[model samples]
Target: MSFINKMLPNVSLIWPDVWQATLETLYMTIVSAIIAGILGLALGVWLVVTDQNGITPHPVTYNILDKLVNIFRSIPFVILLTVIYPLTKAIVGTSIGNTAALVPLVVGTIPFYARQVQTALVQVDPGVIEAAQAMGASNVDIIFRVYLREGLPDLIRVSVLTLISLIGLTAMAGAVGAGGLGNLAVSIGYQRYQSDVTIVAMLIILVMVFLVQGIGDWLTRRTTHV
Candidate 1:
């Protein structure tokens, strides 16, 4: 179409950089997702096991972790990035690249994913959990076989949500020179007054998001029995 042709001229000029930025975005997203998935699942299991009537009640520990999750989740990503700049620099030896962007991505996502994991785990049938316990199943067995198994669909759904959120955060990270599509949009498009470039970058991001969502939904539907 005429519209696309008009955009293509501008988009072609920045295609290589956009591709690189997209790769960086994917790297940050996938790495952080793996880390958050492991840690958040552990945190969620702990939260479930320590609540008032859980298998092993420990109000103090639960309270501490709960507060910690809330505190991290409440902080805006921009502020969190600035606040953790020193740690980022120390860890990555520079605070202005794709690798350095992982710090805030992980920090911002862990609490969010943990909360999602908790909600998903909590939705598992209480009767199923009780039955597992009544059968002399160990706590570990109950958590893995009962809780996680039953919550798989919801977990996938929420993981999708978390991944999508991470994309947005990566864009914000770009503002600080993380060099992703966000940076492409801001530095090349907005700052340079190239509306066409901005639009293309946004479209690419939107396409990526929709792809993620579609895959997540398919997985959820396939895994879910009810």
Candidate 2:
């Protein structure tokens, strides 16, 4: 109780800022996630479809996209941020805020999510896809209904993974003055030696990760049947 009392004042003073940072983090994560999810899913489907033995194989296209995805994914994100800073500045008109942070966040996450989507889609039953094709289903129909539907659980699982990763990336965005819990921890907590603040920020991030994991598990279970 005494410790709680001692902490209350500081908590009260910082809580609003913390909450704001959290919201900024969430905004960046969600916006980027949605964009990445859609584009990555399409890219993943393209990768699969254009592979040597796929439904519509195209060696050249597949190889190109494959190399592109690999190349982007290979770049360390810290370097990616600096590499894309000009694009970020051009797009957002400033390279140092939550909005500007979205550029690298999306670029970093898209390749990751695309690979996950490819893996998940590949795991879908080929027989099911064949059956859909036999029924004269269009390519789009087979993709959405067969590939996506069958891969829902894995997609959710990977999405949870991606979202958690984005949280960490958002923190890194703070390096460019994109304020979030990461920025708060680094700028105020670490720089000022406010251990309590750092601890609290870490705890909050941990709680958020666990919550996302729990939701992913529940969704995966719900999509599966005994």
Candidate 3:
């Protein structure tokens, strides 16, 4: 207690709020990452499968999905939160809490991650895909067994990048009343001139980002086949 007070004088005063805010940020990051991962993976796969040279080529579908991804990825996340406020409110029944923030977070992350997934998938050897096709493997088999399996390491790498970006986004979300460290730092710490509080929140976020990067690197190394 004494040491903590010495180390985080202002933060110790509001330890409970800091703890709660940390939990909220984690909640937003994990939940949004999951939903975005699944959706992004599916979207990325569709983009690949519909490409003119893909196993099930459909240029029209590919172009549409491609353009949509580009459009979404072009929007800045902070503006996205406001642009999608009505949708967020509709989905979560309010547009200014942790849960509501998930909508924008997921939406903002999906396009970026989808592109990463696409890049990772496209790196799989075309010859390998061809051999799989020759063996009577269905598109599903090629996607899951070949593309996803072979790209796992790269996927993990990009996912780490995406997740780190998402953590920053969570802070931005917090700035807009989403209830996280960003909110703690911005609303109270910075605004109230509590530099110690701001520093504590920033340090916690940095630790989390580095931890994610370390874990991601370990997973990538373990999964890499070549």
Best by TM-score: 3
lDDT of 1: 0.88
> Which should have the higher TM-score, number 1 or number 2?
1
Off by over 4 Å in 3: none
Among all windows of 10 consecutive residues in model 1, the one with the lowest summed lDDT is 1-10
- lDDT by residue for model 3 over 1-226, one digit each (tens)? 8998998788888999999999999999999999999999999888888888788999888998999999999999999999999999899899989999999999999999999999888889999999999999999999999999998998999999999999999999999899999999999899999888999999999999999999999999899986
Per-residue accuracy of model 2 over 1-226 as CA lDDT, tens digit each: 5676487545556778889888887888789888888888888889988888678889999999999999999999889999999999999999888988888999998999889888888888889989999999998898789888888898898889988998888888875588878888888888888877777888888888899899999999999745
Instruction: Tell me which of candidates 2 and 3 scores higher on TM-score.
Output: 3
Q: All models: lDDT? A: 0.88, 0.86, 0.94
* lDDT winner between candidates 1 and 2: 1
TM-scores for all candidates? 0.96, 0.94, 0.97
Give every collision pair in model 1. none
lDDT of 1 by residue, 111-191 (tens): 999899888888898999899999999998988899889999999999999989988888888877988889988998899
Cα deviation at 195, candidate 1, in Å, is 0.9
